[model samples]
Target: MENTSCCIYTFSPYIFLNAYGGLHGGAVAAVAEMVSIACARTVVSKDKDLFLGELSMSYLFAAPRNAEVIVDASVVRSGRNVTAVTVEFRLGESGGVVYTAKATFYNMPVASL
Candidate 1:
């Protein structure tokens, strides 16, 4: 199993809206994406030119309020050109999961860019 890395980000009141307030969908997606990239950097043998191929996320529950958010990603599959990762975001204190996502990264040559 590939090693996993974790990141903790702080959330503010403005991140939420309606009754269930704390981290909008877009915000969660952003964090999940960051987690995926971090995981890819840790697992993938390629350079930094790789691009995120696809992302899938599931919002499990509402996030906590005025607390630090934690994100973690684990390597699921690794290849010479592609890397798959699973990521999750949760409340720092309670460790309650708020969102989960999967991302695939593909190495893109700099000449293609």
Candidate 2:
């Protein structure tokens, strides 16, 4: 299957904001994971199972509430047992990068039952 290279996410006030009224770190991490998995799924064969092995993120700026953010994820490396993806979160349109993440996924063949 062809993988989607990028997607847009809109932060809801209730779901994405922290008590301080900024985008929550955990929420950002979750989105990074989702995007990385989506990118990894594009390159793997149908029978192979992909699992997230490691995820790391750097927060460069605070994301504003109720804004549309762009998430771009791409496969940086694909190997026999592992795939690495990099994801970036940017504010609407030309806004600066708010966060960046790297995710590693382990690719394993599914055992037939």
In TM-score terms, which candidate is top? 2
| lDDT (Cα, tens digit) per residue for candidate 1, span 1-113 | 46455444555544454466656788778878887787677665554476889999998887756767777788888777778888877777888887889998896655645
- In angstroms, give how far residue 11 of model 2 lies from its true place: 5.0
Alpha-carbon runs more than 4 Å astray in model 2 = 1-14
Best by lDDT: 2
* TM-scores for all predictions: 0.76, 0.85
Q: What is the C-alpha lDDT of each candidate?
A: 0.74, 0.81
Total clashes in model 2, counting residue pairs 3 or more apart in sequence or in different chains: 0
TM-score of model number 1: 0.76
